[model samples]
Target: MSAVPDLNTAPTLDDFESLFVNNRDLDNVRAHLSKFNPIKTMRMARMEIRHSAILAWLLNPQETHGLGDKFLKAFISEALRGHPTAMHPSALQVSQADMMDTEVRREWRHIDILLLSPANKWIFVIENKFDSGQHTNQLARYLKLVQSSFSKDDFSHIRGIFLSLWDEDPDDDRYAPINYGSICEILEQQAVSGRHPLTAEVETFVKHYLEIIREATGMSEEQKELEKLARQLYRDHRRVLDFVIEHGKATDFSFACDSVFGEGLEHGNIVEVDNERFVFNNCDASSISFLPQSWHKALGGGKLYWNGCENWAMGFPITMWISLTVDADGTSGKIRLMSEVGPASDHEFRHDLINGIQNATKTNSRLRIKFQAGAADEGRKYSKIFKKNFFNVEDVQDQERIAELIKKALKDFRPEIDAIADILPKFASYGKFGKSGE
Candidate 1:
């Protein structure tokens, strides 16, 4: 009943069936076309970074992706043992439309997914963490809300899940943990089984998404073969591909951030303060700014507990730096007026600096700052403010706003930095016996 394509304009019926539709092998044309699938290449792959997207897909049972109730049941089963067998497929009556509304409360907190059933007296909270670390006991706070909202009987029925890229234990013992690998397995099983009859379109989409997950998990033989072919193709046409790639937009957020920060700050009166670390003196060489690698080394050295902060001032009793804190989604960033006293510093200096800053921050209520004396190698003590999210990268106004926030934070902290710089000399002169005012 379908009209045949004209040979000149489109592939003939025989060619289409043989080379494109029915072909299971990775042909050059298929490989090239696969790159253009936004779901496979961008949206699905990006779910590894964007937790909300993954939560939405998984929480929705009626999405007709043919994995109905399967992902949710598996996730719930993994997160909670002794869960009601009523969570099975036949007993599941999840309305994808209502599930999001019941789960997500935007004004209070941006929870990834929430599911509630009054009849069953059940509550499930899923907090999805792809790449970003928790900042301020986010899981604990969310659990508190859940407890307060429900009765003691209902509270007993609650299950908290921390969904991550890998099997990570939650900071809170209350939360059970699961990972993307489980979700990948669910999709793979659904694809293989004929139990769920899906439309051809849905099947193709699921396969594409599954491929992305497999690639991310390093389990994709298809990906390996395609990559090998790509390398050979690039070797044969290196110059042409290189030119095209050089002019293309960056696929990685860190690369874009590096390019923007490096180019924008290079014109300033900068000096290499730490040549080994590639830290630079910025703002007429008063404050210390980090080159991209230095920034990564400083912040990405360990598990990122706070937001990402990249630059700071140098030559103080405590390490004071200006840092840009980007959110998990890479949508926006805030400037952090951050400082820390590390164990590497002299014990006398550390004690003196911590004591002085603690006193100063208390009296200076104008800035509304707090002091946290953290463990040496653990979290960094910071006074972060002016939290803003910039979406439009091309907007000069957004860029200027970030610059202004950085300038304000520096201006506010200048007096403390000067005091620290002043004390460093006195402390050096008096040796380890230096008093606070000395």
Candidate 2:
């Protein structure tokens, strides 16, 4: 049983039934709804399904499959009876039980769901909305927060998504460039088809934030592509604990004496870092170690490998490995870090930072770096390589060329961030996250 429909105040019971329960002709329903008032089309998502049972009944008119579907039934039964779960979640959280607050500068960080990879890369933020609207400053704030605390590992991939209702802008593309929209939808979009959980503006707003992340970072295509590849590799896993045990410190974190791939057995020379942090800080190798292997006896199964001279040892934690097509019998892609994990390792911050990565395979299949040479200086870089032996352009022209290069560099990061912003309006409602003006 459910509360009586407030047909006198809004659309009639017939409208609700046709739109959901006996929806054999959705396009016709949409067409009718559009012609009836037009405004109803945009406002329908704003209505919360207060009575899950009633909602379910609306979804299944004639007892179709005994109880219709379990998820829908469960969601409806609980809501109607007064128990609520994540399905009809209540997320007007003030602090970091959400992702909106993380990106804003100087705010005390409290990540809702923090993802830590064996390589130290993390998707540290997740935002939720009830509807889609033009995204607010929240998206930008999250990106800024990550940038502020970024390490080589932080750069591996900072993921932020809007789990909300539907898009505010009906005419715009409904997803981020990559499959980011799909990922967000997994968590935000409503079970009901056509009707999003949130609003369109919220999705657009989130996408705008992603654009900011991509352009501001100025990451190279090669690097961005590499990172994209690595994310795909680890998306479905549960835990990934690993360690370099030892690498150089931040002030002088550079290494690379020789080749770690010159011998006997093979999978090709593959270099992998936690996420793609080809850099590291000083650590007391003697004090560094793994999770004792026994701790995760039942989690899953992977592999391990290594190569290097006796003095400056090298090895791979099965948790930090990546599979490549070109790796026929152990030719390229092998990895080597410079250090040893012993009894006295650095423990100030148990995380790594990364930058300059991309996805070389499917949008879902990602690749990670096993290690970078101690000599790889992690710094801001320009994409195009100037091969000219000399510069003949006038000083002003050269200045403008440099400016154009800077602008072009900024343009590249847009794809990643924008991809994220595209899917934000499924779970949350309008006016959430304080509505940004810009």
Candidate 3:
């Protein structure tokens, strides 16, 4: 059957003047696009294009899902049009088969598309997704896989390619897409409203990339297919719009959410909501608790005892950077002393025994600290963690109370030596580096 008719779609650079890379009126731009039949605007399916583009355009680059990613994948393949090198040829293969289902194991490395260039001794393997970074490694991996499938003789002449359209690891070979329709007009709006750094970078990149993408706009089969898809999407959305205006809201909004969900989850309780989300309604949280101790005495601590020095130390892996955050709001900051133990005396802080723990108790309290000496590669490193992450924050008034308690506790802590001039009062000596204490 013949495809639905698309809007004339003869886009010119002038048509998208306002939507140019850095021009910022994004909301109006998107509103303008919403008026167009989306399928006809991008020349693709309405259901397929608009919804996916919305997500890919709104969220973190690594988080786009479903058809948005599929369209992105298709769009990237379209880039090979004007691009040429000692690698891929101008004409290439699309979604060509890599693995014939062995009458069994179905979807493995179902690579989105592959462009094999006999002339330039290259092969391009592509995997696309709507918005996020999940497929970051796919290009290199799929390229390697495709190359490995060939006999060693083919390896010498074959080079593989992996292309992704959205923001991926900065190292990926990305190019600015020179869009030409209502889609083109919307790119600037999409970037601005979304505040996308990578998309904003397009302003800098697009001017330079014009020649490359102009050729790509019309060259290969992938571009043609994409153009066809874009047209179909535009036509469909237009029909939807007409229907909506006449009848108010179509019968379908979250139309295929269920089918999409079923494709992702297999067993009980795993519901496919979106690419990055899941609803686990059946999970049992009651039986979960900490591991019991000294099932160890039964196991008779041999290798396992020293193997876990947790008894002798606060055992847990820590990052190279240690953070100590403090919060002193107003009404709620007093030490609920552990073991009826109040704050420490000067002797404890002076002796440097658990000074870190003591310093942490102070709201926004800074410290000049020395580790047990052998703590780091060069003795010790000083670093700071923001308050929200590190400290036990209390209301600002409570903080004063906590401090008052510490002062009361310090009255009892007497170190063997009182003449040591290097140790200063905690807050009095607080400085950036431990140097402030002295």
Question: Which candidate achieves the best TM-score against the true structure?
Answer: 1
lDDT score for candidate 2 against the true structure: 0.26
Q: In model 2, which regions exceed 4 Å deviation?
A: 1-114, 118-120, 132-135, 153-155, 168-438
lDDT of 1 at 229: 74
- Candidate 1 deviant stretches above 4 angstroms: 1-33, 40-44, 47-51, 62-68, 81-108, 153-155, 227-438
lDDT of 2 by residue, 150-207 (tens): 6755446454433333322222121111122332332232332324332564344333
Q: What TM-score goes with each of the models?
A: 0.45, 0.17, 0.23
Error of 1 at 255 (Å): 14
Q: List the residue pairs that clash in candidate 1.
A: 311-322, 312-321, 312-322
Residue by residue across 133-228, what tens digits does model 1's lDDT show?
765798898878887988967535666778777778788766777777877776666655566777887777667666666777667786787788
TM-score of 1: 0.45
Per-residue lDDT value at 174 in model 1:
69
Candidate 3 lDDT by residue in tens digits, 1-438: 956534344334543443334543444445544654323333322122222334233222233221222223333334444544444323244223121111111123665444343333344443433223343465556656776775545434433333223323323443222233223323333332343344444443332232222323343354465466556544534543343345442111111222323322232233322222222211111110010111111222122221122332111111111111232212222222111011222332223423433344353334222234332222223222122222242322232333444323222211201111122222222112222212
Q: Give each prediction's root-mean-square deviation over alpha carbons.
A: 15.6, 29.5, 23.8
Better of 2 and 3 by TM-score: 3
Winning model by lDDT: 1
lDDT of residue 29 for candidate 2: 34
